[model samples]
Target: MQRIGWTRPTAKTMRDMLHIGAPIFAELFLVSLFVMVDTALLKPCGTTAIAAVGLTAEPINVLEFLFFAVQTAVIARMARASAKNDRNAIHAIIRGYLKLTLASAALLAVLTGVFAVPFLTLFGGTADTLPIAVPYFQISLLAFVCRRMYGAMATILKGLDKPQWSFLLNLIANGINIVGDIVLINGYGPFPKLGALGAAVATVSGCAVGLVCAVVVMRDQLRAREIRIPLSDWLRSTWRETRAICTEALPMAGEKVMIRLGIFLSITRIAALGTTAFAAYRILISLQNFAYLGAEAVATTALIFLSKAYANHDRKAAQDAFSAAMVYGLAFSSLCAVLFFAVPGFLMSCYSDDPQVLSEGVRVLRIIFLYQPFQAVALIYASGMRSCRRAGIPSIITTVGIVLVRPSLVYLLAGPLGVCGAWIAIMTDEIVRCVLLFALRGKMWRQFTDAPTPSPAVV
Candidate 1:
């Protein structure tokens, strides 16, 4: 086959990635800032509130990962459909995944709300924190449906090469959340002070608004493309697409489950270190997540464009996009590491006034900063693998790192190294995952090229 024209890693393509990745970076960073704002604002409520929120994070992450798996599945498949010019397949996949995810979200919301106490208690929620944690968990869980809609629509836009639309929608959502945080958390003017619950309310409300905005943007995009699905056939198409989506999503979901479980175990260990230690971790983790925004954005772009490249059978384009994505991921993540090292104290101080908490937070931040680049490489490589429909190996590698090695290291090290030990466990996990996933990049390339052309547009 002649090397078909596709996006090559020329100056123009590089510029395209920057333009695509910049807003994605901002979007992710803004989302992280939601947690940052919550942690910072709730500090006045006392350390228990912070610990409560921190404890709830593990379970919430599991839910986010589930939806994220669905989003990735959508992007991986839709990229191919777009590349193949299969308008019908794209529409079917979008409708199927959106409906399936929203249904899952709604069920999840109810289950989490009903079992909020039991779930929080499993994470070492105490009497004092449970009162705060349970309400927050209940209200926040209800937002899962909204979040699912927002994430699915955003992923669809990305697959269609319309990332700016998602970015703009997310920016509006973040603005709403920040304003809501100020008003609800502090009882600005007439609003009553609701503490931790208020933070949950603001974030959930923001997600709901984001879903609405995303729908509006997506409608315009679809209309522009003149893509319309007949209502009578919608359910029939959705059911057919569901089977295909689930086949792709299951392995990724397993990977997410294992990773979240690892974090869950790590959180349990951190809780044993006491409220001050966990609180410090909460603050430092928020900062660490902020740093990871760049890597996440690059990984997202890699998945969409690389999938498109491969779907078009353009190996060189795939290679170029993957290379450019890794470079972008590492560059931004390394900069974050530098910032973390230079001003760890200031970053911690933003979240807490407690001296011991600040000391612990700074120590954790420095340790985590050292491993950010490794995480960047790992995320990009894994995303590339997934884009090529070789998700199984990456999923296995992640499962081992998160479910077995990391938690064991944490369990053995936390007693001796305190919060630093927990940080070391995570760093170790990132390094292992990076090495393993990087080694498999060639295999992924071969797997995609050597395999028979898939039926229709199923990823």
Candidate 2:
């Protein structure tokens, strides 16, 4: 039997992890900045506009899970293919998944646009917010395909070990978005002020640019000549790749759906707390996103490294990779925690100057700050399990937390404690999930190390 122990990562291990993680971190940071900038810009439009925009976040996320499901599978497959230097397999996976993602995104966008009013209403959009949210959501759908395509391409780039390229693409896209927000949201010169609608238009424009740039970069990066084959053969290869992708994607899709459902339910409860509370809740959530960005970047790096290690049956490498991810993720989250704890009021002030919003946001932000370390553990371990194709158990664990534990706690707590209670429920859920994931991951590590060789399928 092989032995596995908790070992500290070496210098080389840290460097390699940093090499992969830095770009991913930058990319995620830019994405978060996009949200923060939008929120700040929307301030002048009033809390209703801010709340209206926030109303669209979960619905849009639920819709985007279509892209996310496929993206996860693509990254897993592409990591394996890159490990083997199988250019043909990589090309097939990219083409098949990209086509499917674009079509699905387009279809979902149309349906979402058609049902925008009803969908926003279901998320607890009040009369004031509905008018603003519906049009904003419908307009945002125009960029749905482009945004999804950019995400798909970015994953492919990461799989190919070219994360910097993804970061560069996003930087350009979000720069455009931020500038557009200033000009369009407030109306400058020839452009009329569009308020929340302006933010939606800016998003559409940025996503479109990002998609085009991603295609160009992808083409340049994939310089391999196309394999000439009969149409039947081509179709067969594409179908096989798509089927494999879908098989991996289905479980992830369920996990994502459950998470969004939890958020959806949480939003309904918060929305009932009135616009001030809801808006404050939204701003704090946006601020809290900073805490996760580093952890997510490290998790993505761990996923790619774990995928390759599992594919090659390199258990030691996988162990070291996981260790590096946990360390890096925790360290980064600690920094964010300090910032959250130190100046909760200052951070809250960035989005709104309203005294009540600031007070309410500061209260919840501090609660969220305490759970950042646990949040990091949960994210890294979940990604680790997924990389080994053992996503089912982690998915189930997370689903229970998000679907059952979280909502139940919120339903019980939110009434008496207000927004603070809702966040406290979230914090509890994170700690519970973190502890469970840590134990499960240890068992998984032992199984991998004890096996004579990596199992051909998930153990």
Candidate 3:
């Protein structure tokens, strides 16, 4: 029988690569669109509404990355489990991680929900923005458990080479969110016009539905053995496994949180520039994310393939996976760059009609064109590094760039260059990050060259 990871690069390999990546891209695109929906829906309530959303988003982004660290850790380990064809190992990994995640999530929900106002205030909440932002943030925090669980399950599906299942489920969740946004934001059909609070309600409601659906879909897959959910030793000690995951996951979580903190601090500075600038920055980020998400999806697909191949002792397969990932990732991001450069106005119009917001958005977006290609490399290589557990240098480098370099440049340059300086600082950070990641590529793959392989048996 031909082994799955032994195939050399060919048209079929490329096709398979795309087949794995496209749904991931769609899922990422939909996630970004979910955020954009909030921004767009609230546009009618004025820029204050937009600013409140933006402020509230930073803290949420930080929290998401905290769980994202867990997801990344899960994907890496699960990929190896898949490669070994060991159902027991995969089950054990999931069970320990999910329990740890649930307990942590419960605590996080309590802390974040209880201190929602103080957290928002620290991020950039003004007296004006607080009244609207606090309730929205608190309500959203209440759904953190469901949202984090949904993400964990989706990561498992992806790690198991079942991206489509998770994508379809998320699409359903998004549909529910859209309906809630339309009716609740404007009080349509007896839904109260709660503005920002309504948006939060819609988001939480979507997550609740998503949690139920993901659990069901994942359960059905387990029954078919497309995924293996073992029923044994349910009360066994998982401390060792849980500790290993946490050790690997904590650095990643720290790196991301540090990066978010820098951005949160930067947001405070931008907010001081006035609401218009703050809102424009938010819109610009969403636009850039449309491009970033594609790279992210391609990176994720590569991570799964590379990790699996490494586990199977197939070095060539890992290399081929990275090559295919970069080719597709760069192509997608390059197209986004072209669109942003050629028709910035058209993209901006999707979110706002205000003349000032449009102008500032265009200026900042054009600046992003210089960084998009480098962004692709950074994301692709970073994924490979993290998958192989070579996260130490990558994490440190990311922290320095996002937390130290970018903000320092912004402080020094934003005075003379205005918002363009902020964008320029971002570009410079990506360029530095690309150079570092490229430099470390060899080290990233070297660790995997001698990795131990496990049995293909259930026990």
Candidate 4:
């Protein structure tokens, strides 16, 4: 009867999330690494092949980001419900989002699979490159529908405030990918000889595994439900909320689309410089993905706490979580930033055996590092915004900063400044978000905290 905190996180909350977040981070990092491994193995196949895979990745990232936007909307709803202790709603949200995600995945997979060849060709793959691209793209399209299930499951786990399970699944999934990459890409022992296709197969296989695991998890939870809840019920009850979430998500999706486009442009700029630069850019992007895992984890941590606090109407707790995240996120980001700049060669050195790739990549590493502090600020605050369900404003900021400003400058500057110019563009975009969000979050948090019957830290 004396529940003080609207949603009280147990000792298990931080611990579990870290468990979940870390593996998710590591798995993605490993997946990125597998690409590097694929490229490394494929390097001997020739530069044209590497460029083909690299080029195909841009549209793939765009596609994936769109799905991510949907997941974000679903996660926002789940987090809100978790905060409110609406357990019944939680189950329905899970089933509802599952239906939405599966239908979308099925349609997109078919379309992408059907047109895979042309899409890659349009991206710059030549006849020789197209052979590799086609198989790889075909594999990607098939596996990705299953991948969306993993994505949705992971989000549901996180939304349920069980980040640990999400992380565990990723860890297991990454392990699967890394092993498959080693064996399939290089044809270890008895594995049949396959090239880029092998790598794609391996990657898809790993995601499929994740999908199965996700299904098992869901089944375990719904042991009591006789049927996966009907679509009609969801439309009647949650269609409005789903629409509201998607409305918020559209800007966020647009912003991420811009990022994918900008990065695609950056890759194009690098490719224009020729093979060495393109290979280097691929490695650099992979490394950047690894480096930003910390930023993402911290941001996610902030988002969870904010969601819980806001649901409970606990302004003090929300601020506490926000303040703690900035300090932690900044400190962690600064450390990685130092590593990126101070010894980038060491970082670049991990993935490739080529000297030219190392040399070209190391040059822009520092520029990317410059954005780390700002990246931390922006991501953490953005997470807070997502929690507050004011995702639209930050979404606008991100779209302007990432989609519009960054790519335009990078495209214009690339001819003169080379690869480094494109990275500088990336740094600038992040800083813009940092400045803009910092201006907004504090003022907004004040409103929630200034309300009556102050939220108790513990229930």
Best by TM-score: 3
Residue-level lDDT tens digits of model 4 in 249-297: 7877876877776666556666887777677776787777766877887
lDDT tens digits by residue: candidate 3, 222-285: 6676655556655667777788788888878888888877886676666677777777887888
**Residue 297, model 1, lDDT:** 89
Per lDDT, the best of the predicted structures is 2
lDDT of 2 by residue, 126-206 (tens): 998998899989988987778888889889999998999999988888888888999999999999999889999998999
Predictions in order: lDDT: 0.82, 0.83, 0.81, 0.72
Lowest summed lDDT across 10 adjacent residues in model 1 is found at 1-10
Better of 1 and 4 by TM-score: 1
Q: Which rank order by TM-score, best down to worst?
A: 3, 1, 2, 4
For candidate 2, the TM-score is 0.87
What's each prediction's TM-score?
A: 0.88, 0.87, 0.88, 0.83
> What are the per-model numbers of colliding residue pairs?
0, 0, 0, 4
lDDT score for residue 78 of model 2: 83
Error of 1 at 15 (Å): 1.1
Can you give the lDDT of residue 423 in candidate 1?
A: 89
Q: Model 2, stretches more than 4 Å misplaced? A: 1-3, 42-55, 124-136, 185-198, 224-237, 273-280, 352-366, 450-459
**Best first by lDDT, ranked:** 2, 1, 3, 4
Ranked by lDDT, the better of candidates 1 and 4 is 1
RMSD of each: 3.6, 3.6, 3.9, 5.4
